[model samples]
Target: MKISLKTIIAGGALAAIAALAIAAPAADNWENHCAKCHGADGKGQTKAGKKLNVKDYTDAKVQSEFSDADIVKATTSGISDKAGKEKMKAYKDELSEAEIKEMAGYIRKFKK
Candidate 1:
C-alpha cells in the first residue's frame, strides 16, 4: 500500500480540525443560562444581578478568590447568603456536569 504526500497532509489537516472541533467549549449555554444575571460582559450589572448581589466576574480580585472547582460547585449546587437567602439557583437539573465545568471556564474569561 502506498500513501501519497497529499493524502498524508490532508489527513493531518482533517485530524487537526477534528481535534479543534472537539476541544472547543460550548458557550451558548452560558449566554442562555447566566447572561441574564451575570450580564453579557459578566459585570453583574443587571437588575436581578443587583437584587441578588451577583458576583462581579470582571473583577480580578474576585476572580482570584475562587477556584474553578468552586465556581463549578456553586453553579451546579446553587448559592445562598448567610441569611439563607437564595443568591443563585441550582443548575444541576438543566446542565450536565460537563456543561457546568465549561461554564466555569467561560466565567473565568471575564477576569480583568
Candidate 2:
C-alpha cells in the first residue's frame, strides 16, 4: 500500500483543524467570555465587575481561597447571587471539559 504526499498533507491539515475545534487558547477564551467582567488584567475592575463586586484575581488572598475544582465547578455551573439571580452564565454548553480545565489554569495565572 502506498500513501501519496497529498494524502499525508491532507491528513495533517484535518488533524490541526480538529484540534483547534476541540480547544481554543485560554487567553482568547478569557478575552471573549470572561474579560468583560474579569478584566484583561484579571483584576475584576471592569464596569460589570464593579457592579457585580467580582473578586480581584490579582489578589494573592483571593487566589488562595479557591481550588482548581472550585474554578471548574463555578465555570461549568455558573454563579448566582444569594437571591438566586444569575451572576455568571454557565459555559458548559460552549466549552469542552478540557477547555474548562485549561481556563482554571489560566485563572490561576492571575495571582500576583
Candidate 3:
C-alpha cells in the first residue's frame, strides 16, 4: 500500500477530530449528571435535588474559593459522603483524571 503524505495528514486530522467528538459527549454526560442534582442552573433547586442539600453551584463565593485541582478532587472524592444519605458516588474509579478535569471545567460554567 503506497501511503501518500496527503493521506497521512488527512488521517491524522481525522483521528484528532474523532477523538474530540467522542470526548465532547462524555464531558457533556458528566456535566448533565452533575447538573441533575446540582440543578440545570447549578442552583440546587430541583425537586429531586433538595434531599442532599445540594451545593449552590452558582455561588460565586463558593466557586471562586476553589482551585481547579480542588474541583477535580471534589468530583473524584465527591463533596458528600455516601453514609446516611445515598449521595453521589465517588467517580475516581469510573473516570480518568483528564475526564474529571473536563468535568471540572463543566462545573465552572455553572458558577456565577
What TM-score fits each model?
0.74, 0.85, 0.63
- List runs of model 3 lying over 4 Å from the truth: 1-27, 80-86
lDDT of 3 by residue, 22-105 (tens): 555544665556667777677888776797787787888978888989878877886655465436767777676778888777
Model 1 Cα lDDT, one tens digit per residue, 24-94: 45477777788899888999899988887788998999999999999899989999889998888999888
Residues 1-112, model 2: lDDT tens digits: 5999999999999999999877889998999889999999999899999999999998999999999999999999999989999999999999989889999999999997
lDDT scores in order: 0.85, 0.93, 0.74
Where's the lowest-lDDT run of ten residues in candidate 1?
Answer: 19-28
Residue 54 displacement (Å), model 1: 1.4
Task: Give the Å error, residue 98, model 3.
Answer: 1.3
Off by over 4 Å in 2: 1-11
Q: In terms of TM-score, how similar is model 2 to the real structure? A: 0.85
Ranking by lDDT: 2, 1, 3
